[model samples]
Target: MAEEGQVIACHDLRVWHGQIRKGYESNKLIVVYLTAPWCVPCKFMAPVVDELAKKFTNVMFLKVDVDVKQLKYVPIDFGVDCGVESMPTFVFLKNDVVLDKLVGADKVKLEQLTERHATIVVYFTASWYGPCKFMAPVVDELAKKFTNVVFVKVDVDELKSKAVDFGVDSMPTFIFLKGGDVVVKLVGADDKVKLERLTETHATL
Candidate 1:
């Protein structure tokens, strides 16, 4: 549970939804963290989210506990009709409309999604895989260089359901999307040169 002026609880999801609606009536932005109690990653991200809320006063940070009985209406309210498939899923909203979604615990990716206001890039990878290991730094570097791009590294091994949902069959698969449409897809550990070409050809960045 969060203290006063801190994280908003899942029980208050509906109330916060109304508040966000009102805030949106005034053209304000709201950031919601949709999580579950049993999720280890969500537990790990609680403090980080708390600290970020304190830092960004203008942006409202609302925590939605998926496990909460009353909060079952969340996915529908947020337009996630496909269903709440992963934990620590961060949904960004502006004027009561969902702008983007982050399916895992990647602080940098979350920040960039908020900053850029662009489509999210979900990278399917794994920990033990060698190519994934090699491409991790490259993806990080690209995220740094391309500040507008939101890069999310999804561990296929950990999030098998998510991988299956995205139809990811290979390790180190890159899915670049713009406004929910996949702009590009790359499988395997892409080198810097190949990445540059892909970025230029597809994303035009």
Candidate 2:
């Protein structure tokens, strides 16, 4: 419904920049909701993000319809390397660099995660792995409790190239990254208590 570069009114305006200079010069804190039209979760999270934009005046909210030709400039203009396997990929940018990213519509958790600088927990797994299924619930629960940490899951089967780049040799591999560097890695389904302790130990350092 919203056209490229057209500022739509909800709670904040969605800026589709024609050039990187325009996008970068406007603000320091930019939240871009890269979405598609048919995505149900995107439709649901749109309003929630708008509400958050209203609350956080320091940040600017923008919507990029991935379906549009104009939106293709994202990867080239911004140096974003990730593929859009799913819709409603929320990317938090600070000074043109990706600070945080959320793949799905976990609105409450996403808001909390983006509120501060925190460690990122990335779970790399495949759907076929039984251990991944076992780990999913645990990861979900941990994400809910750890508001300061950003939790992400990468389906290795779907994103094979990414998995290879990350050196994921097994299923349900959890990588804890701080400041874009890998600090710790836990292979397979791990105890929730131990995971929490690992996060705690990292957070204090």
Candidate 3:
């Protein structure tokens, strides 16, 4: 099954900070949005943030209200780190450390930033397919080589429902997923070296 994306609202300062500390890991990206209730641009950008949250399951999407007078650090904690000089600032972090920042409601930049951090691979196969059996070892080797990327194998016969969910109509189809989106699709059991090259090209970017 595909992982679902989420957006968490921060109502408390220390509790949200602690939660972020616990959830922040190397394999996932943390996206913190600094917004305010009175800012028109922030209000307009709210839906975009929600959409990004749904699209990027590997990202931790957080929304913080700067005007909420109740919280202390939630409003101004990472102003410098995130370079938040304005409302609706987007902060991207990795391993609890700031990696990138974006200002305003730019949908294109948001998608680009999310793509840069997500890494995943999905293989769709069936027992009746001979090429799928041949490609099993290559997939296993890829799982070992790309430790940072998630590798998934779906049996078309065993999980017919899931295969339909992923829109898989053929056997031995390989899907390259990033930020909960399919970036590439292959219909046959391609060569092992080409698979590695594909993974490397995406992983490094």
User: Model 1, 1-205: lDDT tens per residue?
Assistant: 4432366665765676675665465343457888887788888888888876564434567788776777777865765532435777888876556778888889888766655554356889889998888888888777655533456778887889988888899988988776456778788875658875665454332
Regions of model 2 farther than 4 Å from truth: 1-117
Which model, 1 or 3, shows the larger lDDT?
3
Ranking by lDDT: 3, 1, 2
lDDT of 2 by residue, 1-205 (tens): 4432232322222235432344466433556777777888888988887776554433456777766665566644544543545567777775567777777889887677545534677889888888889888888877666544556789987888978888889888889976567889888776767887887676444
Deviation of model 2 at 131, angstroms: 0.8
- TM values, all candidates: 0.50, 0.45, 0.58
Q: Which residue ranges in model 1 land beyond 4 Å of their true spot?
A: 1-5, 79-85, 118-205
Candidate 3 residue runs with Cα over 4 Å from true position? 1-4, 80-85, 122-205
**Candidate 1 positional error at 35, Å:** 0.8
By TM-score, the best candidate is 3
How much is the lDDT of residue 5 in candidate 3?
A: 64
How do these models rank on TM-score, best leading? 3, 1, 2
